[model samples]
Target: MTTRAGDRSDGTTVWATPAWRERATAWADDELAAQGVRRTGAVEQPHLRPWSTVLRLPTSAGSVWLKAPGPGLASEVGLYPVLARWAPEHVLVPYAVDAERRWLLLPDGGEVLGRRLTPEAADRWHLALAGYARLQQRVSRAADLLVAAGAPDHRPQRLTALLEEVADDAAAVTVTDEEREVVARARRERGRVEELAGVLADDGTPPTVQHDDLHRDNVFAHGPRVFDWGDAVVAHPYASLLVALRDTAAPYGVGLEDPRVLAARDAYLAPYGGPTAATLRVVEAARTVGILSRTASWLRALAPLPPHEAADVREAPYRWLAMLADGESL
Candidate 1:
């Protein structure tokens, strides 16, 4: 059975029910016990974007975050180990796994940095991003070995697929002629991104794993542990950077024009770097397409929304669309 948080009608989140949680908890206990730890209690923390449930379990040794993918759990199992092996220098170590329970036990890192997303936080984020860039360089090489060994391609195809699906529904969501025009423009831009993907796929190089969703909540400060590798994929080098740029820009109110966004992007691509401008453009286009598509999908799924909620939903995509339309970098 599905255990839901928030409004079920909205389809934002739902997870395994009491029995499922109990089974998962029992499995977690076993996993932790193997690691010389014991679970004392658990607290729930809800994440909004790509909604999921995080359980904070106190252990005899310390606390660890038990992230159970509401619906995306299997994806986590597939990607986390690969990331653990490839980007060891950049991400948090995954300590234990309960494959049947669809849960991952990560040492509870400290609070997330940039709670407020200020310029100072941006700089620190930039430094952290540089570390990710270095990690990506190593992972890119590792991806080749995995591919030769016959592993699946880990590109951001989900984003690509999501965009195409959303673009088709744009007309229903677009209430005005002007809005329709904007939707048309977005569709055209997405086409460019698709073309770029085809070009990349045709090239001889292997795809690198990317954290398709790289928002602040996924990253931890003090500990510098990047968690939630469920969205990892083997894609073009710039795919991860693009997601990071959009994530960092949104929190800080930094537009695409913000030098820090570009600087961070540059820093990320500096090592084992490919075509900076070209790759960024493709990723940027992809990001826009992804946002547009997701927004459209959410709007469609929750249609005839309550007036207040509908207004909020309607304004969400346009806000980002306006930012992009203004030719801002983010």
Candidate 2:
């Protein structure tokens, strides 16, 4: 059945090639039949979403989504239930979590929201940002439990260390005297940068659920249902804005100056006095350092890079460090 991955069929079955794909599908079929539904069609989304296998299955009853996440993502399984308790409609409600097999049968999440803008798109975009903020606020109240459940800590404790590390890392690379001086200035000015992030959802403030990746495809068009919590972190929620701003701005073909884009920013910042130049700076700083964090994570996942080529592999992230040292906004 696994002739190829992301295969589509009008027939009553869907196949994917996750390590657990076959076992997960058989379990899904058994579970569906127990509910008196029979599978009729299936298709896999072509995109690789972290480490899970996503499938769309048509059944006698309705569409069912199969997500068999890898071991590292067990936290996401529990997060769905947590969201259900926090905000009922905020995320898709999984019908069941086969904890032992590490899969979930969920109601189909609809298409990605607004690939192109419509007049109505602006309103939805605003609402999605506001909704994201509210979700973060709610999760902030439960930060301890979430961290216990394995959400990451990207607060000032982490950021302060990151700044120091970036400075050290950049120094290891060749830099001009001016850039070195700039890095020294950054170290001295680190307190203010920490204060900015700390005042948000970082260490000093209540930690919130920050969705580090919010590309349009990760969000659904119908209810704007957000999926793929694999990279969710309990960090400064402003970090989420970095990804949001880039993805949101791209489709509108306008910079942050545009009214619609500004509205979206305002909506996201409504609880924090709306968007301002200062807030933009915080957003930029958080994501700029985040570039290194993300790079390190990706490298770790693809770990044990040949020692000889390791330095070459690290050049891009070192360059990001150089940018951070120069105080250049990402």
Q: Number of clashes in every candidate structure?
A: 5, 3
The lDDT for every candidate, in the order shown, is: 0.57, 0.62
Best by lDDT: 2
Tell me, by TM-score, which candidate is best. 2
Clashing pairs in 1: 154-233, 154-234, 155-234, 256-329, 256-330
**Predicted candidate 1 versus true structure: per-residue lDDT over 1-330, tens digit per residue:** 122224232212234355545665677788888888887766444433333456667888777777765332245654666667877656667777665545677776677765455667776676666666666667777775544432334344544564444455555567777777766666666655566556556543445755556666777776465766654545665556656877667765778668766776776656646445665556554454444333532444234233443455565555545444444454
lDDT of 2 by residue, 233-254 (tens): 6677777776677677888677
The residue pairs in collision within model 2 are 11-40, 12-40, 12-41
Q: Name the regions of candidate 1 deviating beyond 4 angstroms.
A: 1-17, 41-50, 115-120, 141-191, 198-206, 273-330
The positional error of residue 111 in candidate 2, measured at the CA in angstroms, is: 2.2
